[model samples]
Target: MFDSYSISELGSIFVMQGFAGLILFSVYLLMALGLAIIFGQMGVINMAHGEFMILGAYVTYFTSQAFQHFLPALFPAYFFVAMALAFVASGTLGMIVEWGLIRHLYKRPLDTLLATWGLSLILQQVYRSVFGPREVGVELPAWMMGSLKLTDTIEVQINGLFVMTLTVIITAVVAVMMFRSRWGMQVRAVVLNRMMASAVGINTERVDRLTFGIGCGIAGVAGSAFTMIGSTGPTAGQLYIVDTFLVVVFGGAQSLIGTILSALSISQTQSTLEFFLSGSIAKVITLLGVVGILMLRPQGLFTLKVRR
Candidate 1:
């Protein structure tokens, strides 16, 4: 890869790729954050998580269409409304799933996995039926359509910047909610000891419902950001599900900082490698590296003290 490019050209390539990696990092972090809560904290193997993300994507697509048709003057601000609606829609579905299905299979991890997998298939068909099988792209507002001229050789995408900024804001909010709020306290208490938490007047059931809902809601926001970078399809969300799980697992699922770090490392490595190698090859190499490290430290990059 380095044999053909001059030193200056290589530097420019690296700079450009690094920025590209940051955009990928934002997506991975958002997806992994939600998975960390659902799979890590709740111990539920939700294979349908990606379906929930697609649901959000579809919601955003429809919202954009509605705004364009009925409120063209407000179309520039439609994304904010779409994202909020996405969160609400996905979160509501998650709570319903929790109450109707997941709540019954709490301790049966294998069953939850199988059940959610089936649910994913059902959701995909539903999306295909409703939205058609064609992939759909969102229309960006003029402000999000341009690029920022950082240097003669390096132009940064305006939409990428917006997505990254949104990611930072969401991550910060999640951190505060998880660590500083009363709900955070209740969530931690339930995670540590459900019976003890309930004895202390904490509603463990409610905590479980809200935790799952919030996690899915975050995934919804991720889907909204995703529309900026790629087209939405019934199966589009599946493309990132495995990668998101890897980030969560490799980072120590219970640690948000670990998730952030893992996403950064994986995203940068894969992004740079893909420039020189085939996308599949780049992914294989990244997966191999993660696996090698995990062989020695199965607990992951970071760990938290939890009661047995």
Candidate 2:
């Protein structure tokens, strides 16, 4: 497949595709971080997670429109507001869902998955009714629009770089929150031994709710980031949900480092393959490879060793 390109051309292709993969990696990491916390850490199978992301995208859309219509001069600053609002909107809804439904299905993974899937459909219909069937794209600020030309054959997008930077910052913050914060310690304690943690004066229920909310909140931020790369539609989340889940699972679900590595690996592989083959074929080959590896090591690329 590479025989068609000269050595320099191949080098440029790899470089460009590698950068493209970084953007994909950023999104996958953002989406999977929440899933890792919920599914990997809390053992909750949240099928409606994508809808939560879409909610954030929609929030960003509205935030942009408001800024454009009401505060055109400050449009460049609207993104920060949009991200914060998206996080709050999605996180608040997550907390509500926990109280109304997820809390009831804690012990039943299948039930939670089915319930969330139903919720996803409901959310999609609502989005369609409100936003219409057509996909929407966010307008970029002047600073966000263009690419940096490194050479005749190599250019990098400003937005892509921003996504990478944002991903890194968020990942660092999440890692610190998961490991260093007192709330994180409580969550770890609760996950390790709910009854013991409760006896030790930790509120397991509160931790569960907060953890779920935070996970969904991260998804919201991820969705905001997605608008830079793709158009938002009611069902756009569905397109990425499977890939996000796969990255989480292929990494050790409970390991944040594992999720990052898995996302990076899967994204680069698929992106590079896409340059040489069709998108669908690239995805198929990548998935098949992942499946083959999983057949040999079901525990995934990395796993936390804990006594059950």
Candidate 3:
């Protein structure tokens, strides 16, 4: 990998690839944040999480089409509306799923996993029925189409920067909501001790529903962000679910900071490696490294110490 390129050329390649890694990091963090909430905090193996993300993608596509058809003048600002709608749509459906399916499967991780996997298939078929078998992409505004010329050799996409910005804002909001807010305290309380929380006047059921909804909502936002880089298909979400789950598990389920750090590490590693090797080889190496580390440190990179 090194013999063909001079030092200066290598420097530029590293810079460009590092930025690509950063964008990949942003996506992993965004997706893992929601997985952390659902699987890490709530202990639900939601295989259908990706479908929720695809739902948001479809919603964004329709939003873009509608804006282009009916509100062309204000099209640049349509993404904001699309994001909000994606969150609402995914979250509402999540709450309904939690109520209709997940709630009954509490304490049965295997059952939840199988059920959600089935749900993922159902959702995929539904998407195919509604959107047809073809993949669709949203039309970005003119402003998002260009790149920032940082230097002679390094340019970054405006849309990539936009996605990273959204990830940071959403991550900050999630951190505050999980740590500083009153409702956050209630959620932690319930997670730590559901019986005690219920005795103390917390509505555990409502908390569960809202937490799941918020997780799904964040996934939706991720899918909306994804439209910037890739087209959306019925099976697209499935491509990322395993990676997202690995991120959550490798981070330590109970630690939010762990989640962020792990996502960054895994994404940057796989991304940079992909530049030097085939994509499949890069992924194999990344997975092997994660699994090897996990074998040694079963509790993950960080674990919260809590009394039983």
Candidate 4:
């Protein structure tokens, strides 16, 4: 990998790859954050989580189309509207699923997994039927189409930077909501002791429903960001599902800080390696590294001590 490159070339490669990794990191972090909340707090292994993401992508696609057809003057500003709608659409579906399907399966992790998996299949078919079986790409605004030249050999994508900024804002908001707000405190209490929380006037069921909704909503935002990087398809969400799970599990599912760190490390390592190696090879190497670390410390890189 190093044989043909000079010192300057290597530096440029690192810089460019590092930037690309940051974009990937943003996407992974967004997806994992939502999964962490649902899996860690609610103890629900939602296999259909990716479908929720793709739902958001489809929402964005349609939103862009509508804007182009009827609101061309506002096309550049359509993304914000699309993201909001995506969150609502996905989150509403999450809440409904919780009320109709997931609530009955509490304490049954395997059942939740199987149920959500079936739900995923249903959602994929629905998307295929509704959106057609073709992969669709979003039309980005002019402002997000260019790159900033940092050096002769290193340039940063404007859309990548936008996604990173969006990730930062979302992460900060989640942290504040998780740690400082009254509802966040209630969520923690429910997670630590659901029976006690219910006994003490906290609506455990409501918390569970809202928490799941928020998680899926975040995934929706992730899907919105994803459109900037890749095409959207009925099956596209599946591609990131496994990797998102790896990030969540390897980061300590309950710890937001851990999720961020894990996403950054995994994305950067894979991004850098993919430049020199095949994409599959890079992923295999990354997965092996994560497995090795997990074998040594099964609790993950960071964990919060809670009563068993």
lDDT of 2 by residue, 1-308 (tens): 98889999999999999999999999999999988988988888888899999999989998999999999999998888999999999999999988898989877877888899999999999999999989999998889889999989999999999989989999999999999999889988988888999999998999999999999999999999998999999999998889999999999878888899999999999999999999999999999989998998898999877687
Which segments of candidate 3 are over 4 A away from where they belong?
306-308
Q: What are the RMSDs of all candidates, in order?
A: 1.2, 1.0, 1.0, 1.1
Misplaced by over 4 Å in model 2 are: 306-308
| TM-score of candidate 2 on Cα atoms, chains taken together | 0.98
The sequence of per-residue lDDT tens digits that candidate 4 reaches over residues 195-225 is 9999999999999999999999999999999
Pairs that clash in candidate 1: none
Per-residue CA lDDT of model 3 for 221-303, tens digit only, reads 99899888889999999999999899999999878898898988898888888988999999999999999999998988999
In model 3, what lDDT does residue 76 have?
A: 98
Give Cα-based local distance difference scores for all models.
Answer: 0.91, 0.92, 0.91, 0.94
Clashing residue pairs in candidate 2 are none
TM-scores vs. true structure, each candidate: 0.98, 0.98, 0.98, 0.98
Worst 10 residues of 3 by lDDT: 299-308
When summed lDDT is taken over every stretch of 10 residues in candidate 4, the lowest stretch is: 299-308
